[model samples]
Target: MHIEDHPVLGKQLQAPVKFYFNGQEYKAYKQQTVAAALIANGIKKFGLSRKLVQSRGLFCSRGRCCSCYMTVNGEDHVRTCMTRIDEGMIVSPNLEDPVIRSDRDGD
Candidate 1:
């Protein structure tokens, strides 16, 4: 949940933006991240682990962990906590295993 009653940042003036999650439209602040917006809307689960199939959500909230990884605009393994919300953007949980590119493979 967002800190609407923050002792320091109470109800700051942030531009509103619209985005889609799993095809459903959602409203978010222009400066907010996808994870933050989702949490503000009471969405607890972010994505499921590819191996264990367990639900995961924002953990570190600092882009240090994979707990916030999701799909954004057809891109996989997106760190939602680091990605700022944009107008008309599409976001979805990463349902499958993330494809890791190895440096051994020629780029």
Candidate 2:
């Protein structure tokens, strides 16, 4: 989660700003992710289990795991690990559609 002198993203990240999450406003930076920004601000509960609906959050900072899945800008089941946060972006928790997931399972 260290954005300073990043190998690819570089050091262009700037000061933080207020952004909307669901309905609440949160302060985030242009370099941080919706999950990373949220976690750094003392938020651990990002979403719930798909079947049991148990509270879950960022397990691994890397994108290998899907623990950080959430909705961004009205889309559903977006992996927060790979998605960058944008100003005024809306973040929320939602389930992935079983049928669509099944169809895209191997691809």
- For all predicted structures, in order, the TM-scores are 0.83, 0.71
True-structure RMSD for candidate 2: 5.9
Over 4 Å off, model 1 = 1-6, 98-107
List of clashing residue pairs for candidate 2: none
After superposing candidate 2, which stretches have Cα over 4 Å from the reference?
1-13, 95-107
Q: Using lDDT, give the best candidate's number.
A: 1
Over 38-93, each residue of candidate 2 has an lDDT whose tens digit, in order, gives 77667778777878878888888788888888888867777887787788888876
Q: What is the C-alpha RMSD of each candidate to the true structure, in Å?
A: 3.6, 5.9
Question: What's the distance in Å from true for residue 56, model 1?
Answer: 0.9
Q: How many residue pairs collide in each prediction?
A: 0, 0
Cα lDDT, all candidates: 0.85, 0.75
TM-score of 2: 0.71
For candidate 1, the 10 contiguous residues with the lowest summed lDDT are 98-107
